[model samples]
Target: MTHHILKATKENVHLGGFSHLLEPALTIDSGDTIDVETYTGYYVYDKAPPEFLTPEFVDICQNLPPERKIAAGPHLLTGPIYVKDAEPGDVLEVILEAIAPSLPVGFNAIRTGWGALPQQFPQPALRFVRLDLVHNIAEFPPDSGIKIPLKPFFGILGVATPETARTSIPPGCYGGNIDNRELQTGSRVFLPIFVSGGLFSIGDGHSAQGDGEVNVTAIETSMNGRIILKLRKDLQLSTPVAETSTDIITMGFAQTLDAALEMAVKNMIDFLERFVNLSAEDAYVLCSLAVNFRITQVVNSPQKGVHGMLPKSIFSHKINL
Candidate 1:
């Protein structure tokens, strides 16, 4: 019922996403509205070199990183907000209300040894992309006449566990950088709690990205977002799950495509068992009949993810939860 506005400050951000001992930036109870501001990974650490940078942009980039550790996967994450009543066994339900560009320009790049077709692009390359926010279009190369529709969303939204620290470059059971394009406005993510109070974090905004993120980047940009954080104490979750207007999604990640697919299938069956009155055998049959598996992202290092999308209309009755 209360609104918590956290204006992104130098101290309010972490360079790489979640860490084992992240300090909480804000603490609030369930049913609270949160207004958050964040920056893209490149904004905080990988500023354009002096030769290619404009004076204005250089100034903006310099103002960001004196306080944090400069590292890769520099998602410029905001917060490890501790939600009241959210313990290790509960679920943190996040409803994304708005995700928009905070700056006038965004960017995209292909590193020397990265991207889906690294061999084709043997050297590093970068470009400053321009976005027309009022018209909802992104113009690459400034005047390339190529206009891409802007569909902004955070690439990272997750909570931390009590285990050893990890990089923001991987998406796993805790949901760091899933990069699923369907996580637009009106979508909601359900993250499983790990440490007590559920230290939820958010960052890595992208104006638009394709399914595979083949280039290893999208319209990389800073964003301002608003969400409703509610603790789902009655139910427990094994991995991150989400609901878009048309589909219910289960997120799964692992080191290989085979492992990721297996996890996705298992999560799908588990979801059916949790939300429906079906036997285990029946749930598996239902998955085979109506579910679709999608690769969330392949760019995140060491781990990849798949999402099992079950159409909302598949259920014969309304979900009681």
Candidate 2:
């Protein structure tokens, strides 16, 4: 089958929030794969393109209406794709095939009213990162020589719900702006259906990020990536569940850390019981001994998240089935 590619354009992109009422820019059948291009998290605030930034991305930012920059959001999302046969209660399997830089540069920012240490940082600062695509390194300063490996991934991949438009900042059951780095290439994300067609949308690409995302940003950059969307009617999920190269992960979002942690643990327990065939007691015990819970991020207000990780190495039997 031919690969369907969708380029990111001002017409097809949105700022904050998602709703099923928004029209789908593209539609594809189940089991079809699509190539999607996305913008960085700073697309809204970009007044001038950096030296290493590409003209193509600058053109996209320039096309946005002035008011959109104010009300839309900082993150520029690509599309609300209509997947054929996707309906509420079904699961949408998003298989991430590839993630590559679309621009020669990326960026990181520190701003007032943003980041985990907002009180300490009252001023906004922006720093450009030179992406050495060949070397797979994100150089901090050409002279300082600070460098980190490239691990590109889209920060947002969500399905719209039947409710009003939801902001793209905080990730929830719909899967918007979940900055889990594990959702990189070779990962498979399963999102619960909330509306017909799943009204899928994705954007906010990141080159690298740590566990907490405590600074409130990653190697923020634009990217071109491919994903295979498959409709799974036989499965049901509440929040986003994913299997990475090394582990099975379950996610949860809420206002408080305690709540988020509880969500992750409970989801892990459910997964263990359902797939691993462990009894509730056994799963609970195993979780205490094996499951690793991590705070995804604390920056997204009222929607901090945690993910429970169960390593695949523990099982001698392959989980391929």
Candidate 3:
């Protein structure tokens, strides 16, 4: 496999959305590995301390053209990298190899009218935390003696949608803004491709976040990621699915939490039947006995997420599914 490096620059990024019309920043074959640099908070760059900002981040915020910014969302996403031979009906398997902080600071915010409990937090609040790379911890309120361990991951990993432009704020079948904390190093996100070349993009780095992301944001920061992209034509999926070392994750998003959970459970059952060769009845039974459906996120408005995690250890024999 070949290794490529993609830098986050004004020319290589699409602000706020994904569209099939955007040109590819880079093209690579299946099984290629990319070391990508991604930054976040372009809209809030002025609020950040100058010392904490990276040069590339500053350049994008200060130099990006106004037309590049999409009013629907505020994320600064990098690339629409074209995968050679990837086409509609195929699945793009994004393998997370490694993720590290590209900057020494990150911010978490609770904006008015945003977040799970927006009514409770009527006023806007932003807190910047220092990332201690040496210690691999986020130092919150330097004097408070509170340090949260850093578990960095890119919050967005999406392919171009069929729409003219799709907002980056919500996670959908295409996999955008999926704030799942479990998607750290070693996780594999499988996205169903729509347009040709599987124009994939990545952004919205988070140093750490709890499940649900209740306050609307995490330790939002710039991150460097090492990812391996492969074309998975053998798998057919109607929505995004993921896998880690210990469990298989089936995700679903909807307008309500209950609906989202139902979708997730249904997707898990579908996966069990198709991949594990279980009957529909057996899969339904297994879901109740073994699957743990967790709330992935609720802050992404109108698109709450739920993920069903089935532990691989439940099966005694090796499972390729």
Q: Global CA lDDT of candidate 2, please?
A: 0.81
Backbone collisions counted per model: 1, 4, 0
lDDT of 3 at 38: 88
lDDT of 1: 0.80
Ranking by lDDT: 3, 2, 1
Count of backbone collisions within predicted model 2: 4
RMSD of every candidate to native, in Å, equals 3.1, 2.2, 1.3
lDDT of 2 by residue, 228-273 (tens): 9999998878878999989999998998889999999999988888
lDDT of 3 by residue, 114-153 (tens): 8888888989998888888999997677878888899988
Query: Which parts of model 3 have CA positions greater than 4 angstroms off?
Result: none
- Residue 256's lDDT within candidate 1 is 79
lDDT of 1 by residue, 142-190 (tens): 6788888999999999898886466788888788899999999999999
CA lDDT of every candidate? 0.80, 0.81, 0.89
Give Cα distance to truth, residue 67, candidate 3, Å: 5.1
Which stretches of model 1 miss by more than 4 angstroms?
Answer: 41-72, 141-145
As for lDDT, the candidate ahead, 2 or 3, is 3
Question: Candidate 1, TM-score vs. the true structure?
Answer: 0.90
Q: TM-score of predicted model 3? A: 0.97
Q: Tell me each candidate's TM-score.
A: 0.90, 0.93, 0.97
